[model samples]
Target: MKVISDLEIAQTLHLPNECEELQLLMMKYECAMTEMITKLEVLSSEMSLKFQRNPFESIRCRLKSPQSIYDKLCSHGYEVSYQSIRDNLNDIAGVRVVCSFIDDIYLLASTLKMQDDLLVIQEKDYIIQPKNNGYRSLHLIVMVPIFLMKEKEYMKVEVQFRTIAMDFWASLDHQLKYKRADIADADAISEEMKISAELVSQLDNHMLQIRERIDAGEK
Candidate 1:
């Protein structure tokens, strides 16, 4: 992958065309995101070949939008420069893994942390300690080495592991946050969503228990 240096971008582009200039830098993040996605897909393939099972149900990758990155840097009071983004933001590239059961989330997270190539820089086990909003997921910030044309660069990519039920609740919760004008009672709906998150969590544990029993019987 060709790396566009800040000097090259600045010299070729005008000052007003900041977004276009930033978009050129996205190639680094794109490469970094693809590297993480490939690792996840390879893990899924190997698991299916060996155990006829996958630790995750699905894998999703995303790169932060140029506008979003600029906004985030301003929000954090950081310098709005390419080097500032690389130095401060750890979630420029993200990979989300949705699992079938709660245990599968852990199984996949532990497996990922064990990889020698990827270094687990930070971990947040929301399953063990649910957030105030009752959100549950295993979040890991991993540092992956992206081998560029001339030099290798270490980039941080956030990996989120969640169960199907957790994802279902989170998706609806996010949509509601955006469609607030359509709701009759915003506070009431927020409360109900929190309750729904709790219910889905309980459901996840029950399903995990049943899965464990089935596996035990098979063994």
Candidate 2:
């Protein structure tokens, strides 16, 4: 894999002389993360062109390590370790594809999976099975290769597929849930969110139907 230059790693860590060793170690992780994100972006663009769909609205990738790794190293005990960060990254390597209609999400996801370069490690069809919190989207863990001057290494990245309507509702839910402590009962809020989600789903289906009908007439 591409070995990151020591200077670049140093600049990113910004650690003092006392923490020079840790800085070097952190650089390897950072380089791996940077490479993963770059590959994801390229894949996203290619998928967009192949499927005649808009590119991802937003794409991000991250790396993490467990707290035990740090503890075993006998280094300073950081509240957040690389492993924890990596876990969170896996949870959110979110690639939101905001389309004009909801069916576009499924189309885009299916098209992406067909690419040979991308290896699907796991998939959670949240669109088909949304979370109890009304979270809706397709979560896929994909492994992509990053070619360096010396070698090539594969990195895992999480990709989340969602539509504009779903994004809007999720954003609002997050803001409202965090803004107030004792706002409403969790179940009550969840039920309301579910109702909204169903409405959005119906709207997506209706729009797709309209498009199909128009295409039929043109033909």
Candidate 3:
């Protein structure tokens, strides 16, 4: 069994007042994530009706648990406080949109950016330049407005856009890398995954081209 590290221990030692503050801040992030998901659902519906196809296949969301947040802050050499968490981490709340095709990833991301309420803070195109471990996705850090009972607040949420193939590769890669420790040729496996990512990229592009041609009524 893995033992808890010192960072985890420190994060668990937050004061009572700090805990209350952190709870409220986490609630705000949760609300922000919900609003973003709802916005995407609305967009998905509208796009499906207008274009006769949905761009995204599924939407997945996650909010970092309090313990995870605290551990992250401690790992970054910061005190376990709400201020530190807000300043240090951008992925406390995250949403992932899985699409059927490569073009859908970019199209959905562009559509989300066009919304007046969502303020795009940062964008990273990992699909174009995949990570060494075969990771491929587009990441966006956006600020979304959440209207409370008496106040409107904006909170940051990290959004990721990925194709079905990309998500499949990522899921397997994550499991293989983290779930196993007895693999002998880890480096070789990493290299193979990179090559597989290239193949997946080619497949995505080919399918996208075929889709475009079909939409254009071409044989």
Candidate 4:
């Protein structure tokens, strides 16, 4: 058995906890989140092999707690409380998966949801029901079990599946919007962003059609 040193764990967490109870709690959460990410990565790789699809271009998993949540709340002039973070984490146990095409995004999401051990807490088919901002992807909140030496705990994992094209546009939009928030041409840039979003949507549909044709020929 490989043992992770306490020092290594401490380095990863970065936050100092005065109470032993809090330290243990933080360690447990970190370990559980890391294990969940590893499981997801394995699933992603297996899926790529099974479908002969390109490996996921990128996948990210994150775990946030009440303190971190409270900081954000305070920054936004909201109540600074532990419960707020807990509530937010309950809603956003996130994983972002980037794929080669729109169809692959759906197919990968479906494959992951089919795993018997993974319990789907909720699902939002954003690709089919995109937000008004033109965000396109599948979002699923799932519960995965983590086994410790003598116990098992359930952890929430959020999965967001998207295509490379969608990611590219989103990345650019995020950078420009945030980096140039005070620019005089921001309104003009926003309009162009909306147009680009629509183009990505059209491209997604066209790619999906091509994939359907390929599947039909395989049948």
Candidate 5:
């Protein structure tokens, strides 16, 4: 018989009383995210060599913290049950892929979707149609199989594909969102950021056209 850890029991019981349990479960989620990241790394490396061009600039992974999970559940008006956490939260594990060019973002996303083992649960193309706040990225919710010693577990992860300029814009915008501010000043800042996003979008398109012309001349 296998002895289950406190965290394993907590997962089954759906009680958030024990801090250690939440910590252990989050660690396991982190491990799952790590496995997915490694898979993406291999795919990116092989594709770069085959195409003679690197499609991705960088890959990053993160596991949401226990506090964040709890807050999210509360925000959605759900009870803080372990099952609710699993069922309601689709982004417990997240991966961010930054690309050198705008075209590279779509290319990488299509390649990932073609993988047999990964299942695309949902997709939001914020690139083609930017959000009201001027946010843009290709977001994919995918389920990946992770094999363990005893059995295999399928985990849901949010994968975001974006150009370097898009990533930079998002990073700055995230900082602005977290800061406390007056209403009038915040509206002005948001409008300025929207203008910045438009400029960045134009730059991405211009760079893509230049790269395409260069490739065309070589061929």
Candidate 6:
């Protein structure tokens, strides 16, 4: 039995009879995501072999849903077409890399950026300068060439590097903000999450320092 994907279900609901082309487009996005994930996995594996440890703890990837793509285009006052998706949306494919230490995030990011095939189009170092709400993560917009059966196409993917503590705090904070969006104490919740984000960053930095000290034979 062929597995029906969520994107297929979404395309059926939104695009109707006009989805034949979009299906192929979605496949390309999926393939691009797969290629990025493989690159990340290989990097992690090579790091483990060389350093006796993996730089990242986990890897996750996702393709944008058809509905999400449509909505985002509409919300941005852009035409909802394949051309628009190619031109405007840089995050059709996303990859999140979670690391054990804050330094690991930077280390992996620098290594990934140095790859010949991957182009770091944009970089956001949120670890050094977090958001007002305390969200901290390194975001990179990377472009890579995806070779198809007939031709090769350059695709953009959004890659995020986060330490385990940063991921933990961000996941919980996102859940609370999403689930409790209309709660009466929303301001208070936002303030509390901001504080929590600061504490998480501090802890991440502290752990990195401890690891550095250990590496330096300081015990």
Q: Which pairs clash in model 1? A: none
Q: What lDDT tens digits, residue by residue, belong to model 1 across residues 33-137?
A: 788888888878887787667778888888775557767888899887766877898888888999898877776778878988889999999888988777888
lDDT of 4 by residue, 1-219 (tens): 123344533443332332344344445555655665686688777876887766478877665543454456666665433234334454334568887777677667777678787788889887788776666778888777777789987766677788888888888877777866888997777877878888998987888799879978997
Total clashing pairs for each candidate: 0, 5, 0, 2, 0, 0
- lDDT agreement of model 6 with the native: 0.83
Work out the TM-score per prediction.
0.85, 0.65, 0.89, 0.73, 0.87, 0.90
Give lDDT tens digits, candidate 2, residues 52-145.
Answer: 5554566444433323333433443433333443343343223344566666667666766887777888899877787877678777777666
C-alpha lDDT of all candidate models, in order:
0.80, 0.59, 0.84, 0.67, 0.81, 0.83
- Candidate 2: give its CA RMSD in angstroms: 6.5
Write candidate 5's Cα lDDT for 1-219 as tens digits.
Answer: 122356643554446375465554556566667877887888778988887887888998877755577678888998887667778899988999999898788877788799888899999999999999899999999888877679777778899999999999999999888683656588888889999999999999999999999999989
Candidate 5 residues lying further than 4 Å off, grouped into runs, are 1-24
- Model number with the top lDDT: 3
Residue 202 of model 2: what lDDT?
72
* Candidate order by decreasing lDDT: 3, 6, 5, 1, 4, 2
TM-score between candidate 2 and the true structure = 0.65
Over 26-54, each residue of candidate 3 has an lDDT whose tens digit, in order, gives: 77888899999999899899989987999
Clashing pairs in 2: 64-82, 64-86, 65-82, 65-83, 66-83
Candidate 4 differs from the real structure by a C-alpha RMSD in angstroms, to one decimal, of 4.9
lDDT of 6 by residue, 102-204 (tens): 8778778888889998898999999899988899999999987799989988788899999999999989987788877988998998998999898898898
Better of 3 and 5 by TM-score: 3
Pairs in steric clash, model 5? none
